[model samples]
Target: MTASSSGALPQPRRFLRLLNFRDSLWLLAPIATLYGIFALIPFALIVRFAFADGGTHFATVLESRILVRVATNTVVISLMTTVVALVLGYILAAGLWRAGPKMQRVMLAFVMLPFWTAVLIKNFAWAALLQDNGLANTILQGLGLTNGPVTLLHNRLAVIIGMVHYVLPYAVFPIYSAMQAIDRKVERAARSLGAGTPSVIWFVILPLTLPGVYSAALLVFVVSVGFFITPVILGSPADMMIANLVNYYVRELVDFNAGAALALMILGAVVPLIVLQQSMGRGGRHGAH
Candidate 1:
């Protein structure tokens, strides 16, 4: 009998490995504990507070004039952060893909350093660099690009800069994962057909990488929307995002109800986007063919 006819099959490289109540349920305990402690409990508390006083807090936030501006600032900054990070991250991912293995390891380390570093530290470092009489201004003055220290910190530009720095790695990895799955033969065939480097990149590589780009954009924007620290350290009062707004309500005003209401609202908007993005990501399979 042929091997194929013997009814034996090779195990898949990866699979679901469905769990049962008796055998495999315990495997989920650690994650279940962590999620329950951090996520589910906090979410439940927020729900309780949001519904207190019959949701008057929602009306309060909606009726406030600052809500319009805060929402606008949040959207604008998040979009700018996403766009800049996506462009720079695409360049970085492409370079990493083209590098030698040893060089790629070094490059990946460099890319992930910021990701490992705390958001506070990164924003503080940017603050130091962007401050008046700081290195950035000194360099600009030395180059005669500016007559004096420019206003770089506590502004929209600074916020975007810090945000882009924080979120760049998130953008890079998705695109890189997508690029890694691309068949090398596709590029080789295009080049063999007398396609130049730019033509090959534009016609072949770019199209293939679009799935990854979409994934990266969703990731970058989601992260950008949740930023509170960068905005506080590197941005102005007018630049506060949704998270900061929640802090303002809970911490400054000591109004947990309003904070919870706003928090739930953010959760409502973001959860749908996340669910949608995850569904889309499953379809892309990280851009694998």
Candidate 2:
């Protein structure tokens, strides 16, 4: 009838409560196991391959020049594509943001239409348009833009164009959403305070949407580093990305260790960039605070 009567039921009751809490772990155990099996295990294996020798021993994996060149090419193409997509997508998103709802809907549909088409179809379409004697050059020649067929496909430019097209939606959607989230009243208030149109945008809208631009740029950059199919169809050997090189190692050379090393290299480069970006963002936020 003392304190035990009200609060403490019994030792068995406490044991049952403990058991209930411990039972919750069972719910997560399966998912954890699956993640370990599918994700962690494969990653561990790839890392091991990266350190192991591709030819004879585990130590030879880091001694490949092809891996070095491929890694460099991947970085260059990814940066170029990210810059192009970010600029074009930012402009388009801005235009869409400024448009009326009807025009916005139409523009959005147009932007999204390409995504609905299959990637292979898009690649072939680019091939048809950009091939030396294809539609684009024919039109150019017809219009006296050039005297001969322009070399468009099987070049770095073609690779960049394809990557931009593939990554545009990724770049635009985030920035557009960020822009849409900005308070119109902030802009109106700035205008009311005698801020010019450009000033209001530069000072208010741009700053507000910077986070989204950063996010979209990183997303596009990461994806571009791994681009393969579009570049293979539209680009020459010089434009080969890390993913394509990795594919060649795995399939053509039948060197799984080298492929894994290349894959790990790509991951290594991207992870640092991401961390740098996040660090900069946090520092900015802290400074602002």
Candidate 3:
């Protein structure tokens, strides 16, 4: 019995030594510490403030009519942004997938332009172009489309436009990745089976790319929900989103607790969507295998 116990202790020590060699926790320590300090600590504080006084801050937020409207606007605007971004992104991805090497580089450059530009700069540019008598209106008038300037700026439509532009690249990369993963032989097989171009895409390509589409939609929706500057710059007061509401609570109303509660509420809403997306991604991997 003594010998068996002594041997088992050495086995665990040897396993630990092997694990230390294979997986180095020290490499992750710096990033883990930074994340804990910046993200985890703030999140913990928000959660703590949210539940203070037996959750009275949440009760206050729930009772406000303005908050309800803000929530609705957040959902509607995010949905619109997600749908438009998905459609445009899919088209761009398809074009990228079909283009030759030269054209692919050009298209990829355009797709990445927005990523290189700061979000504030992009939003400001959109605001300029969408405003009354701006470039779009100027061109429309030049083409005899409208006699006078249209109310294009400071509205929900403008908000959606800016968001779609900002998020289009995100959608493009994922869908393009999925397209790249598809086997060319399968496409050729379909062609040999007398399938037309449209039929091939509809039956094979679209189905294979559904995972990417879903991923893009979720990413866009998640990003849209967290939009702070775009809506403020491009949208009117009526188009306030949840992030704006949190800002109002904290900055305007000077209610840190309520702001934390609303922020926590946003986190609560987004977490389930993230979990769902992760599960779908895992399912897609399994399907691919």
Candidate 4:
């Protein structure tokens, strides 16, 4: 081509470059719109409602006797759920890690079964099983373990059981992923050095999987904190959690401002946990390398 034509091409290229910036904005417009509508707007409204009447709503929430009890229950139940889920998940993950190919598939199915089931259905099923004269109670009585059908339903234990079942899969996957990353040769080397199976697992496997354990604990705890249905169905009124408290304020009392305040309180508690989880994840990745 001629030098004149080559020089002319630069002008069109510059124009295209200018148009690219506008094109990018157009591409991002939908995402920004969605975020504004769903996340930003809701957050703004929550803040407004929470701070209404010079922050009286927050003061009301904080001063309530029910709030104190609910908050305590939320913390206690979440901690219990986290501990139980971690222990059970670790055992299942260890088995999955050591299983043959066929057994691994079976174990995986068992781990994922809860995920496939709806939360409402699972909770309802547990309620039936744990109720007086239900299967569990009948078995206990028939086996001469109890005089009559023991009250298992509508208690803290039942709430914890339901929470643990739901969060178990969350715990298993993280621990199992960590297990998969471990080298089999490391175990063999430990055995060659006269380490017993328990010694090898305790000293080597457990330490290497700490990141996964930490991840699982935080995830399960976070999920358990937001529990509403399980606690309502399985636990008594006295066993209400933070989410239930929020529901009480909104639905029972018809206090939107107070409900928003309670919700913001939950958000305050959860945000730190989420931040900590993210930090641990990053640290784990770095340590792995």
Candidate 5:
């Protein structure tokens, strides 16, 4: 129909159309812009740097030994942290679950209290505790456990401890949330059917909570892989993570190319794990149906 032949649209209708379009754009704009600026741009930069040779290219930052060792350390540390956090968090979550609601809330608050403090502060606290003259060594010496001040700071142990402290809360909350979602009657029915505590846990509770455990493990691992401050504060040269290398390249060496490459490598490593998690989720959904 010709524009003139059609009845004139009401002002409210025209305004509503404009408002709807504006609202749609508004909904999308922040996410789109943020993805491009924060995620996409950095990722593109890192990919470009990864392939570029570090030396002679002046712009290139990828080095064979540096990349290999840093990547290895990063992966190892991340995996270790994930395992430790998952185990510890699971135990804590179990204990909390067993406790009454008031006690559970208290324990949960205690767990979450560390998160409210700054990460830097937490790392520094670790350093203080692990230092040669720190509490650990003093207690050891006081108990005649060692000859002298044990050098605990700036090592893999220190790094792992710091990371566990940082990521344990993340691990705890997800698993706890999953546990809370579980219906009490399900477990009660299993117990009522003569299933022992171990049987009920193994056959009922664990399977249902596998999704949360997997997700928590994945998230904690991913976060640990990109750890910078904890490693720098508590780790030695040998304990240097990929993220530390990235920061050194970007900040200390002022080599964006190498930094980008390292950062991209971090992203590349995490992407597969994320995909695997998603695939598992899809498979689980399909199986449920």
Candidate 6:
């Protein structure tokens, strides 16, 4: 057809024609631009720094004596935090699952109250409560449990406490989701078959909740490893985790290369765990059929 006779399609029609999945890559431009500017570029620079000087910084970090100690501390604290959070989280999730509507609302609000609070604020609050002569010590002294103010803050225990408080919500959500997926009829049938409360929980509820607990454990432990402020606020120098290694290398030693190297190492470790979690999720998360 002649252009004059047929006329060109209108601009909107042409634009709409280009909007299909294969041709619509431009839709991602804005977010990709922002990510490049904000995330990828900075990360690339970190990689560059880490790989500079024949990649000696990696060796420097590895050879450093404190690396072993800091790594151990990080692993130990994260594991402890995961275990404690798992236990408490299971209780909370179970309560949430079984609660009446009004009580569930209250409990859910209590569970989610931490998300709105800043990490800095929460750590500092824990620091205040755990400090010498703070409320915890006052209560201890008042109850004659201590002859004097006990040292609650500036320890590994304090770090764990702060971390648990921060990460409790993460622990709860996955477990709660798993708990909600449980078939209540299973429990009812167990009871009808003469299974008592203990038997029902042991054979039915506990078995089903295991997947969520496992998910929450990995998630909480992964999060716990990256803790920085909590250790600084509630713990002594001895309690430094892996993240503190970056700060130590960069700020204390004035070694950005080593800091970048340490950061890359951390990224390497954490990314795999995250990938495993996501892969597991794709396989099916906390299903209880």
Superposed on all Cα atoms, the candidates' RMSDs to the truth, in angstroms, are 8.2, 6.4, 4.6, 5.7, 5.2, 4.9
Write down the lDDT of every candidate, Cα atoms only.
Answer: 0.88, 0.82, 0.90, 0.90, 0.81, 0.89
Residue runs of model 5 more than 4 Å from their true location after superposition? 1-15, 18-63, 275-289
Give the RMSD in angstroms, all C-alphas superposed, for model 6.
4.9
- Separate clash counts for every candidate: 0, 3, 0, 0, 2, 0
- Runs off by more than 4 Å, candidate 4: 1-36
Clashing pairs in 2: 52-58, 53-57, 53-58
Compared with the true structure, what per-residue lDDT tens digits does model 1 show for residues 138-193? Answer: 99999999997899999999999999999999899888988888899989999999
Residues 1-289 of candidate 4 have per-residue lDDT tens digits of: 1244445565787757866756767677789989999999999999999998988999999899877888889999999999999999999999999999999999899899999999999999999999997999999999999998899999999999998999999999889988888989989999999999999999999998999899989989999999999999999998999999899999999999999998998998899999998788778843655
Better of 4 and 6 by lDDT: 4
Candidate numbers, best lDDT first, in rank order: 4, 3, 6, 1, 2, 5
lDDT of 6 at 225: 92
Answer with 4 or 5, whichever has the higher lDDT: 4
Question: What TM-score would candidate 4 get against the native?
Answer: 0.89
| Candidate 5 similarity to native, TM-score | 0.81
Query: What TM-score does prediction 1 earn?
Result: 0.90
TM-score of each: 0.90, 0.79, 0.91, 0.89, 0.81, 0.90
The local distance difference test score of model 6 is: 0.89
Candidate 3 has a TM-score of 0.91
Model 3 misplaced stretches (Cα beyond 4 Å): 1-19
Error of 5 at 232 (Å): 1.3
- TM-score-wise, the better of 1 and 2 is 1
Best by TM-score: 3
Return whichever of 2 and 6 wins on lDDT: 6
Give the total clashing residue pairs for model 1. Answer: 0
Per-residue lDDT for 208-227 in model 5, tens only? 77887887898788778878
